[model samples]
Target: MKRLLILPLLALSLIACEKDDDSTTNDPGNNGNSNPSALTNNMISVGTDSTSLNKYSAYVATDVNTNKTYFDIFIYKDDVLDRKQYMLLHLTEIPTASKTLNWQSGANAPGAIKADEFVIYPKVNDKRWFGVYSVSGYETTGTMQATVNNGKLTLSYEDIELADEFISVNVTERKKCSGKLTFLLSDLQGLTTTAQTLDLVAE
Candidate 1:
């Protein structure tokens, strides 16, 4: 009985030691790599209505079960009327440098988003969500340029019009919104800081 107990104890100790030694993970988000943003205080300026969607915060997660890394910017206040509005930017790859990629997130509107597609989804609380696509030959014309460093982005849009989007959803239009606006990272407050300067071209 004594021998049996000793062997079990020894096995348990070895297992615990191994776990301690394996504390490190290969995840770029946790291993000091620029995979997911560690920066907080995120804000997005909706250009159309000239009403900035700076009502909340930004959330970051990594080592996802799906193995995808991305950050979210809250465009609407969470728990406000039991509603949550946010923008989800699913990182397509670990960007080594900043590039102005064509806005393709909502390209597959009224359909499933492509696996390789990089999109910014403005998610509403209900089943109805909307996607703003930057496709060519549309009445809407604009370009988005983004810079990602440490998983933080500076997204800017120039004179982009918001037409009827996916799922037959037109929240922006129903709300009467359109025009150029820049989306960037800042402290998570649904309201933009008054001290911060804004460009009023789209208005």
Candidate 2:
């Protein structure tokens, strides 16, 4: 009789263990190491010396289920105060350590579907307005490379040129507006939050 009771108790214990294991595996709170959704809400501001030109901002967002990544860049004209240019890129995966991102144009690109890519929106004139020069012409070209190591992020841009009409922005400019940024990422925990603004001065 005691053996029979022991068998039943053992069976119950095994069933409970299985249920606990299943519950842990299916838990929604288990977001591995990164929360793409949270990361999407974060924003990074890139500052330049040309205060009257434009202000630049970048964002990293992702959908883990679909394994899709969204990179967004915003250019706001300080003087206009009513118009802003936006550029967004969609990729198969979020940039974790290091990767090269290509520029995509058109109305069908990743962020394009949501009207988040290559768009200009009107804004109300406000004293706090800031902006970055429009790089609309070079949308089809250029590469963005980034690296993350030891909690430091390095972002570099290459071969990014301006349109003929806007050539003056580059002419006689020794820097040519191409440069790399290096900053600490201690504040950007889990890569889901925004780090502090970094200088993006040309050169």
Give the winner by lDDT: 1
- Candidate with maximal TM-score: 1
Per-model TM-score, in order, reads 0.36, 0.33
Query: Candidate 2's residue-wise lDDT over 55-134, tens digit each?
Result: 33334444334445444333333321233222222333334577665444533323332311222111112211111134
Report the alpha-carbon TM-score of model 1 versus the true structure: 0.36
lDDT of 2 at 96: 54
Clashes of each: 11, 5
Per-residue CA lDDT of model 1 for 1-203, tens digit only, reads 00111121221122123211112211111101111132222333233223233432333323223444333323343332233334434334323346554444433431222333334434332221224333342222234445544434445433333322432322234121121222333322222212122121111
How many backbone overlaps does candidate 1 show? 11
Which stretches in model 1 have alpha-carbon errors above 4 Å? 1-48, 53-85, 94-96, 105-117, 123-129, 132-142, 148-152, 167-203
